[model samples]
Target: MTSAPVDQQDSLAAWLSIRTTVPWPRWSGERAAAGPPAADGVRDYFTATRGDRDPEGTARVLTALDRALADAQEGRQLNFALLTGWQRYVLHRDPVGFRTLPAFAKGGRERYGLAADTAARFEQCLSQSTQPDLPLPSRAARTYLDVLFFHPFEDGNARAAMLALAFVLACDGACLDQAHPLQVTRWADDADGAADLAVLIGILISATQRRQRHRSPA
Candidate 1:
């Protein structure tokens, strides 16, 4: 029999429901000690908690993320240098940056990503999203979705996307309580996937705001 269908909206809705009900994970001592949550503080917490998950690459991605956030906060546009720098760190010794060859995901469930030549155009779209016209939550959510669909890097695109989303939030003077929601599996072809993610993003934004309020001293 053919594989059962995936209900993209239902899947995201359920995930969002459960996530919002739970307590946001406790902040690490490093994060708590950072005075106020910022991009570097988030990186510090992420690196401390998660560094061992990919011992060889965590430092690099963390460093690159800090750099990218610094630039993005100044209204700088994303370009090849920023991305390749991140890839170099995430991939370590691997020479590949953007996949010149085709890429696949989860056994090739979705269609191929944009053509290699469209990478510049992809960067343009990403940059445009950061304009003040768009809400930060929408920009962050859309950036995460863009990274999911663009598949910009050969490896570690998911991680990169998480960082990208976090950066967008941090740049807007907010920090997510957790980045785990973006780590869930996704399919580019799902019609409701992008919209659902936007909903999740809004939930995350509100959750983070509450978290900040609760954590702050009176």
Candidate 2:
């Protein structure tokens, strides 16, 4: 019998050291940067709320991210997002009720969306949407933009957005987190005091170029 491929959680943990005890860098740490937006006004929040031996034995923050992405894809509206202080929780877009599904992630916060909820509807309607027009790198760029537009989660929107994009690139054997933690943190800190997808797109573009060169055929 053939073994099934590993799920997204394992892959993300493997690449990202999710829920690990590895020596994290002093800087570029979500632990150091949480609560109130940075002075620079990092738009979106990219926090990591690991507990200090707290209740939930092993927090599956990555899993939460996976669910949020899937939920957004499912065209389901969610008003009851889990916005916890632990585990990098911060809503991307806001007020995504079961009735509304707006696009434009951070800026697109609609208290009352059309009964038909177009954005989520469009996402659900898409087929092979994962495949991008540009090379894998550009495709990666688009995913960051699209999810940021969706803004599914109430917290950890950027991290979740980055993870979702990472999953797609990994499908093509390209990983973004290969960039240094400082690099990733730079992008996180660069959130436009609202988690600007455009800034993150720039970061992803640079990382993709590096990854392409690194993985280039010798």
Candidate 3:
């Protein structure tokens, strides 16, 4: 008799379990220096990654980014409705909704199983983007991973993740000048990788501020 295929473990659960335990790096409240507005790194990222093959799709993403940034600037809370609004543009669809079935990624190695409370849990996670205790980098990093592991939408989830990351930083008046470095495969269960991402975000924020300072006139 042949053996059956092994069931994939719930990557989402693994992520939620370790989310609060990750050793997020500390930040000293450093922010980007005052100067001429920097080029939109999130726009550049989408353009470079998808513009060649899908110009229309890239345009949609940029439009979504615009809306996300606007909401961030207005101090809007991050939630499913806000995300769905932007996601409609990213996906070029009128009626986008959450994924009802389990989602898989990384060549089917990781699965995000949906429970009745999954969406509620996701919203709770998003709300933490404004958590008072955690520093900006940690909050931003956590929000990014929340989107990644939640795998909320049926499609365009990666784009959604990037938008969420950008929005989280923008909420605090922080903008990264280089988002390319953040494009990497993130495993749901890797606690060290999660913390490393926070460190990387902190570095990018400081680097952007440094460049802005250099460009500013004395």
Candidate 1 all-Cα RMSD = 8.7
Weakest 10 consecutive residues of candidate 3 by summed lDDT: 1-10
Shift in Å, residue 212, candidate 3? 0.6
Q: Rank order by lDDT, top first? A: 3, 1, 2
Q: Give one digit per residue, the lDDT tens place, for model 2 in 94-200.
A: 34332233222223222112234544442552222354333444444445533443444334545544555544444443333332332242121222322333334
Residue 72 of model 3, lDDT score: 93
State in Å the error of residue 211, model 2: 8.1
Residue 143 shift from truth in candidate 1, angstroms:
1.2
Cα error, candidate 2, residue 148 (Å): 1.6
Q: Model 2, which residues run further than 4 Å from truth?
A: 1-58, 63-115, 119-128, 153-156, 178-218
What is the Cα-based lDDT of residue 173 in candidate 2? 39
Better of 1 and 3 by TM-score: 3
Put down candidate 1 lDDT per residue, 1-218, tens digits, no spaces: 11323532222223234432322222211112223533334465457657878665777777767776776677655655666666666667456566564445565544333354557755775675566655566567667766766676767777777777766776666666555565567655444565566666766666666566566787
> What overall lDDT goes with each candidate model?
0.59, 0.35, 0.89
Winning candidate number (lDDT): 3
**1-218 per-residue lDDT for model 3 (tens digits):** 11223576788999999998999888885765797347777889999999999999999999999999999989999999999999999999989988888888877778888899999999999989999999999898999999989999988888998999999999888898889999999998899999999999999888888888888889
Q: Is candidate 1 or candidate 2 better by lDDT?
A: 1
Model 1 scores worst on lDDT over the 10 consecutive residues at 23-32
